[model samples]
Target: MAVHLSEPDRLLPVPGVRLCAVAAGIRYKDRNDLVLMELAPGSECAAVFTRNAFCAAPVHVARDHLAREAPRYLLINAGNANAGTGQPGMHAALACCAAVAEVGHTRPERVLPFSTGVIGEPLPVERITDVLPAAIQGLNPQGWMAAMRAIMTTDTVGKGISEQVALSGGTVTLTGIAKGSGMVHPDMATMLAYVASDARVESGLLQAMLGRCADQSFNVITVDGDTSTNDACVLAATGASGVAVESTEDRDAFEAALLRVCRYLAQAIVRDGEGATKFVTVRVTGARDAREARVVGMTVAQSPLVKTALFASDPNWGRILAAVGRAGLPELDVDAVTIHLGDVRIVVDGGRAPEYTEQAGQRVMDQAEIMMTIDLGGRGHDQAEVYTCDFSYDYVRINAEYRS
Candidate 1:
């Protein structure tokens, strides 16, 4: 039921990265719930974490470790977010890093820890630490798929992508994986993603690229208008391909490819959203600025009325119009606004278009994928798009019984 999404047939490996997945019994049974990613020495790594004031303990530890030294390994666990446990949570996160360092023969500062799952619970540190040696022993370049599954909590399908971009010197590979289903919104979500490349990139440039790509991808997606404390996105460059992304042309190509992977993963999360029956795209154009456009698009995307209408396959354009009108735009001219559902113009000059018909709107709503465009007249030329999903009966059931 993942809309039009499917698991990747294969994920090409980055030369300087090795991964492994193992069952730690931290939360789930008879399944891998822990993943370890080893990065080559001297690899450049950059990361962005959730801005929530109460971020998870692993986010704090990972940020400190990344600042102190280049990461040699990334330790991740599912089914326990390790957030809201305060000082005790911080110690648990650090203990896991210490265990990884002991087994991998690296400094504790060289390890970054990430966790996702039920919040406000004590992490089973022993469960994860007991499996570190095995995880390291089984590390292989082709463990991308298994790692993707291991890091999932509520995600129904594994989300990942692999691409090869040709530079002037040689071709470099990029592979990324992400997990999320609910508690998703802008400023990051209840998601964790990691992208690795074999191309050589300066540390500063790598961070810049990640921020830009994240703005276009993760930052533009919403599910239920809620953000999580454990959200993070990381980028690692191993330089194993001997391809330098230094030149302007090379930098542009590398960033473009990175954006593609990020966008694909972001959209996949929406397609697999909890109880999602439709993949919805809200595009807001002709705003005063890019930020305004994004704000408006997100407002529409996060509206429960709009989302439930989508789930029911209802051609209720009024829900969308109401959301747009409340987007907090000043001096807004309702008569200048226009809206479209798929290729059908539902609203023109701020009211139902004369040529519009319920049958035509229903035809578009009945599809598994939908696109809604709102034109804010000629206020400006800026535009933005937000990806979301419809809410269904299962969404409520899934969260209501999540702890059970």
Candidate 2:
């Protein structure tokens, strides 16, 4: 396999994070599909995962591992999502983690495993185990690009984002990488994301913060409105910064920066979605509260009619209204609605804005990035935003024969 990189391939160094990428070839023919991210000892962790009742074995196993030990390394593979394969799947996932722990000289509980692709088939632990030594030897700061690329399946580009934040001990850096393209939605975490930071944060608090941040970030984005069985997002801190940040100001700054990195990569994931052409940003306002607005916003963004029109570049506003009416917001006042495609302003106060013109709507739809805003007309106190992408026939083609 050729090294096809993405816009997020730029190299970055976060103080405590070390990455290694090697070809395990779990399902892919030649390229590296397994990545090992080794975080320094004393590193804290946070995670969010899919709410899908039938989630993969590794998803549950990793959560249990994090509960038992502070994370030291993460083992991930693509092209073989370990989902729906019964008892054997659990054993294989545990074995993969054990192999990594053996190499790191850490307990198996200190390692987490993640897998993606072809549900129901057994994940070949031997593939990763055979390559573990070389994978470890390949470890370094320079492998960020390769590590990010290794996690992709249908994603045309690798997604990574980095930033630094100030804390009580000082300023520490955060780095993150993620992958998702087709089976995307906003329940728990809809895809895979791995993040590490150098700051000292408590695992309990960091997990809580990560859940909240993703609820507003990953949980709001939709690609085809389908949730994946392999969705996993984890945050690990190496405590290399020597700063214990507990103050509200310090925590908020760190949280904000973490959110920034996650959001950037999440958007990039959607942008590189299989067969994706246009990136869509949906913003909803005027609901009674943020929750209500988010429900309505995601409902609109996930509508097939809405996305299909996007693929065709057809300027359709009625589809948007139809989605909102059924959004389950309880007595949603249709009369108090307004919508806009970017700045074109299509609907005004429940009806087509008098100035609505096909030419203007066409201009708005033509942009590479499309923004659709809705005003429920309540107050500024309530608002929600989501990100998604246009659906095309290529999306169908890619997933139809995905494992074949």
Residue-level lDDT tens digits of model 2 in 1-404: 11122565375676677788888878787788989888876778888888899999998899899888778888889889989988999999999988998888989998888988888898888988999999888878767778888988877777887787777678888888888877888874447998888788887889888998888788888888888887888888777878876899998999999889888877777787677888888899888888888988888888989988988889989999899889887766777788999999899778889999988998988777888999986644688898888878887888786851
TM-scores for every candidate against the unseen true structure? 0.99, 0.95
Task: For candidate 1, list the clashing residue pairs, or say none.
Answer: none
Model 2: pairs clashing at backbone N, Cα or C within 3 Å: 43-237, 81-116, 81-117
**Winner by TM-score:** 1
List per-candidate RMSD values in Å. Answer: 0.8, 2.5
Over 355-402, each residue of candidate 1 has an lDDT whose tens digit, in order, gives 999999999999999999999998999999999999999999999989
